[model samples]
Target: MEQSDFYELNDGAKLPAIGLGTVNIQGAKGVNSVLTAIDAGYRLIDTSTNYMNEGMVGEAIRRSTVPREELIISSKLPGAAHDYDKAITMIQESLYRLGIDYFDKYLIHWPLPMQGKYVEAWQALIDAQKFGLIKTIGVSNFLEEHLEKIIDKTGVTPATNQIERHPYFNNNEVVETNKKLGILTEAWSPFGREINDVIEHETIAKIAKKYDKTPTQVIIRWNLQNDVMPIVKSSSLKHQKANLNVFNFELTQEDIQTIDLLDKGEPGRVEGQHPNEYEEFG
Candidate 1:
């Protein structure tokens, strides 16, 4: 899709509806993958300190012909760096590694609720924004309770909430909560980690045939139609181009409902890490 297909965040910043996710991809391969996606018209690139490839992403951006202002670069603070000091250091490190002056968006990678420092981490993010180290700040893998804690303590609602969402695990409650709070909902594993059951589902397959698109495209379109920006990862140029080709079609109301019925709630969670119960610091 064109860069204009961006959704306005709560803070009035624009985020591209579709982004290329760089998780587990690193080195020259990662650089090439990101460059390919950018050349194919993707304007947003999502990475994180946990991904360990912000350097590669930086290299891609540096080598690309695309202007820095024309791209929306995002990275996340690691859970290990959940305190104010560590969070500040990590944000600067990400910028240094990305070879950029500021991030289009910076997110707290996870709540790490068990560690009990996410509120402080959120404060650090707010401070980074104030310093112009980041243009927008948000969270990932944060449930409603975690979100409320930060908002209540800081009076600053996140610009967006990135979560693992797919047809199998819709997480409608979180999406609705973000919507109510004017926070955009971003879907991270939009294909449910390539679960065969979801990709091979009858309803998705039928809709794919009707739209002359793959189940992957139909699913991405489903996210867009539902107002959730989807970050899809692919190392292959072919798949990268295919993923961005989804903006041309529209899913019917009945088709959307059919996909909606695929939701299995918590049982369908691919990552299986409940934010409240997960406490990993590294």
Candidate 2:
């Protein structure tokens, strides 16, 4: 990744602007996809304990031509491990699964707000960072209330917050909130996933036509312009390369606004799983 393609975190660690998301990527296929992504210039690999492929990610790293030190491999803590002790043990277990001494960063996978244990989860991550079990700590799927509660209660701010952002639900409020608090926002399923077809959207397609680029390229470019880094998962090597090719073009302010108008607010959520209501225990 180039210097311009890196976002320095609140804690001063750098992450690639584009990341490889390994949600369903597992086994031999998962390993090959990750290895090829590294070779294709992706430096950030995102997975989760819930994804259950930390071991495969480690194997991919070992097989990669790129040095491990040069890449940022991040995983998340699941909702099931919200208790402080459970969270700590899970972090350590994740490292063992990855076959690594310490993770570059680890995240609390979700707030699971109803359970009221995200604060405990945050405290666990803080202690894990202190114990040198992880280099950085962050959260994912945290809405405004959860974000502030964790930071206010723990007196610590996350380095990043991974959220589901796309044209249909740009999540500008949360993204702006994160920006104000010096937290980087990482977008997951930035294309709106299965519920919406971002690549074929009218405005995006129009923009792509004008630029002589694919809608995929245009959307990625728009994401970069909005300052939201997207973690795009594709098992295909060709798709990986396409995701990283957005750096060459710049989207105009008007183009960005035109795309932003596509936002359908809360209804546009890919799975309608509000962090507040979604409960994934494991």
Please identify model 1 stretches exceeding 4 Å from their true place: 1-3, 194-196
Q: Assess the local accuracy of residue 171 in candidate 1 as a C-alpha lDDT between 0 and 100.
A: 87
For each candidate, give its TM-score against the true structure. Answer: 0.96, 0.97
lDDT of 2: 0.88
Estimate every model's Cα lDDT from 0 to 1. 0.89, 0.88
Pairs clashing within candidate 2 = none
Which regions in candidate 2 have their CA more than 4 angstroms from the true location? 1-4
lDDT for residue 166 in candidate 1, whole number 0-100: 90
Q: Write the per-residue lDDT of candidate 2 for residues 242-279, one digit (tens) a residue.
A: 88877667889999999999999988987757988898
Alpha-carbon lDDT of model 1: 0.89
Clashes of 1: 0
lDDT of 1 by residue, 1-282 (tens): 443677987788888879888888999988888899899888889999888899999999999999999999999988889889999998998899889999999999889877899999999999999999999999998988999999999999999999988999988899999998899999988888847578788889999999899999999988898899999998999999898888678888899899989999888986546777766544
